[model samples]
Target: MAQSSSGTDGERRLDLIAMGRAGVDLYGEQVGGRLEDMGSFAKYIGGSPTNTAVGASRLGLDVGLLTRVGGDHFGRFIREELEREGVDTAGVRTDPDRLTALAILGIRDPDSFPLVFYRENCADMALCVDDIDPALIARTGALLVSGTHLSRPGVFQASMKAAELMKRQGGRVVFDIDYRPVLWGLAAKENGEDRFVASAAVTESLQRILPLCDLVVGTEEEIHILGGLSDTVSALRAIRERTAALLVCKRGANGCVAIPGAVPDDLDDAVVERGFPVEVFNVLGAGDAFMAGFLRGWLRDEPLEQCCAFANACGAIVVSRHGCAPAMASWEELQLFLDRQDWPHRLRESVELEHVHWATNRHRDYPELTVLAVDHRSQFDDLLAELGAGTPEQVAHFKRLALDAVHQVAAGDPRFGVLLDGRFGARALEAAADLPYWIGRPIEVPGSRPIRFEGAPDVETSLREWPLNHVVKCLVFYHPDDDQEMKARQDRQLLRLFDACRATRHEFLLEIIASKHGPVDSTTVARVIDHIYSLGIYPDWWKLEPADDAPTWDAVQAAILRYDPLCRGIVLLGLSAPREELLAAISAAAPFGLVRGFAVGRTIFHEVAAGWLTGVIDDAGAVAALAENLRVLSDAWRTARDARQAA
Candidate 1:
């Protein structure tokens, strides 16, 4: 690549700011079986910003690379690679002793080519805007940013500086909200909710920069978190409310839709038409490719829909090949992918069974199981007595409802054992027992209190008699009065109960009430968890709060943070508990990625018939619902955990 003459700050051309990359990616041919099947693997530029820069260059954009690579071989490779791809290296810098980002491409499964990232102390993590010439950004056309650049001590400031410079000069600032949950370091290993709250400062960091962007790109998933919105329309509403940028959300296969205009349209009737679906390739650099295509179209003043189509075409090509950019197609090559559907069809159809099995595997390693219903106000006598006074036939029906829940889970997943909010009563349990298949050996046995963690008198006897996993029921309290007496009870008597069961094999739980939890008052909760674990015990999960009322966001978070056995989200206790409070708690915890696994007995069973209404309150039906809900919670827990780690 030829070096451009040092020009005046006002006359620079295409001085792009690819502001967010902390590592380097090396692509080489795949020799392994898994690699071979995922298509030929070739070493290519890896960072999203760098990849976008390369793609733009290939598309005839005069682009500059502005990322910090380490003084090591990896960093050197990144610089060399970018230069070869026709990118301007005027902004590249080196850091001695600091390593460049490195990733190993291993095709573990042909279905998805996993790129194992190695990014502990890379030099790029040290980039400062001072490293880039201010004159360059003053004359640039667009500045690009990816989410990865916002991490610890230094790089974040550096990336932000360049973007601000570009914006100040009336240039366009582009954002790719490719939020990586893992690196955000929310609830991963740091200290639960408190640490999560602290780490969530990323939101503030993003707000500082997003306002400067001319356009922000994100997927349906990323939009949900950054914009705190669910569907496409809501995401646009939220983003537009937050920043003055044109927000474009990438919808895979279903096509892409850009929120029309800079302001969100209340014309809830605002028009949004879908773009065409192109084939999905490796998906590694698709977003970058999309940016490349979109930018090319934008520079030409193309229509919004056409811009999306170009981006889609670019993404389709990159995904089909290996790496982020070596295989990026030209304008004409992009058309070929958009016109075809066979690759997309084969990719989707070939993985149904494989995905199911993989899903089962993940459940074992990462479980997010939650049980709803059991709560503090609940007593065995109360639940048993109300068995929805019914005739013999109706009673039998209730039994079947409960039984179906237990049996369904036992049939599908080996790791699928979680407590049930059993307020629906014995009929539901009976139905679960009636189920025929035993997917795996039962984890708990019937009619037994869980074995305590420590030296409960005669603890050995309890362990011998009760099989822990089969209990499949978690106990919780929706609310606990904030009175000193209640706090004392939890700290003393309840704490002792936990103490008693520490080392026993009959492991189960009596979760503390959450909804009613108030002011810190003391450090008892955080302390007790350590005590319980010290006795070689693990809580299956915690219901988090009371069943009757919604838990305060802080209260739910504080409780969840105290323990570390991958507890599910707060379980709802009140049958009539309004979901609004839960929604608030959910929103509070979501940004930090602190929740997912949840349960509630009252919320589920209270709405239907008290006794067995064959249609409304059948026991068999409850069992089925239980199984489905368990799987849902388990999946949620797993996702948060995986994303946190990857981020």
Candidate 2:
């Protein structure tokens, strides 16, 4: 529903909606170069709205949190945490039949933290308008909500109703567009062998939520994904007129600018406010904090730029600590940090920026472009599990999503290539039909002999009958473990396999210990080195792996480089080796650009592999903990891969 032009307006008393599920942040995954054998995590209440409430309250504002929590202890704990931070939690609803949301927070290193949420069919999704306290919203200043809650019908309906109410009351509605693809329904192919995602459902759901918000805040990349706008100004302008609200576009470190309206012409016509700078520690809550601060500024009648600064400062402070809500700060604390900065100021004649010229300038002309979304073999399983599709349909649907993802990424660049790997779900044949490049194995079909992927020479060949390329990411764990007997067999095959693949000169990903056939002798190392040097095309990248016998990073490097010098990356395998240690090896090997990465399935899947992957009755109804472990492995790979490219 559109906000009524006819209404009573006053100082904003924000009715912030924590529409998304709330949960506790748990720590897992590889950290500090060692695998953590422990499970206990420092508990903290975290969620987008929860953090926003704390950040806003810290900034001193009137904010109320609305959402559902279970009647369980975790739910009660969540409410208490909100109240402790001064957030008005009386509006929160309780569901007797459900459980509170919990987030599995993990660190692959300092930066690559991925979250696996347990909120499917949970209490948070049960939030409906019946749970809403209309009086609370009626007296509020603004409505702040996140897009995550849009995944479900009841919560979605409730959020929509609240937005309508806020609009009718002339209160501003702010949306922090955080779309977690994992949360938006995907499912696996039931045969326990394959998985895929439905593209139409994902797209249709995204389109449903874009029009309701007034001031939208999200990263440039997120905007590109949601709106398909590659150009900065044009994308903001494109989404402008679609909704009557101001379009606030974030350019990351460059700060954010708000368009008066969402229209192409608004780029040149709107009031643009530049942000004050702050040394950012954590960007997690900055956008939401910014929204809270913007409302805070609006309530206090402060200038727009000051609001952006407050938001950025709030974000900067949060990032400097751990979790979402670090601690709320007073105005003096924020201003003290701001005043310490020595920035150039303008009086009468500083720069030519502030002066407005009536001259109509030509906007940068961008070529007509196609956007393709690449589906890495990594996402195959998760997409499958989430979309809930059967084998045949999963293959077909996954094929399209994969093709679309690739096309989106390669749109502007001519050299862009889609790579399909058989190392993923049991069905790569569907994907292989389209992609031209591959790492290993021909895409295989189910319940029969595998078929060759139709593209160029790739992993869709022999020996790919395994998940080596998928489970063993080149950055984290390059390959799985094999006995000395298997090692001897591999070394003998390495030369012949190298020659056969060398015709295409395909570079196979190898773990030195796993590939070494005969012995740890230098002659054996030299022989293998000679073969690797022969067909030298880097297949994206080749990673070094620590030997099962020798877990140290130096030993792994010395073992590989004693034979070949180009070992830039390493995979930390071996069941006993700690993830933290492996990370340290990555750090130590930085001199060789060796700080690159590893593929660690066992390190991640050890829970399942060790028979420790089981959960109580709660996890019993869903997929096995091992399935989750595998998903975690896949998620970790995506995080690691993204981190590498981002660097």
Please, what is the TM-score per model? Answer: 0.47, 0.46
Give one digit per residue, the lDDT tens place, for model 2 in 1-647.
00112125653344454455576656442343322443545466767777677667656676678888899989887887776566777678888999888776544443444456677668877888787677778877677777677667777788888888877877777777665556665532121111123344543554565566666777665554455456666656555536666566665555666655445554434444555443343344456556666656655667766766666655554444345654334444565545655433321121111011000010111111111112234343444455453344444344444344333433434222223343342354354334432223322221111122223355334433343222212211102233546434544444444433422223344434323323343233324334444433222234344432323444445545554443333433333346555444434433333324343433433332223212222223222443343334333434545554577
Winner by lDDT: 1
Off by over 4 Å in 1: 1-12, 26-42, 106-113, 186-200, 229-232, 262-279, 335-647
C-alpha local distance difference test of each model? 0.53, 0.49
CA deviation > 4 Å runs, candidate 2: 1-18, 27-40, 186-212, 228-231, 262-283, 342-647
Best by TM-score: 1
Q: Write the per-residue lDDT of candidate 1 for residues 1-647, one digit (tens) a residue.
A: 12243455434366455765735555535533543354533344577788888777766667887777777766776887676666777677778867877665643433454455566666666776577678667656788877667666577777688788877878888888766554566534222111112223665566567788888888777766666555556756767877877777776665566765653444223324354443454567777888888887776678876787788767765665556766555544455445655545433232322222112111112233344332212333344456644444443454345345544554544333323323333344333343332111112222222312322354343334433223323333323334555444434434344333332323344455332345432343334445444443345444344322224444445654554424433332333455455433333343334443455444444434353343554555556665565444445445545665577
Model 1 C-alpha RMSD vs. true structure (Å) is 25.1
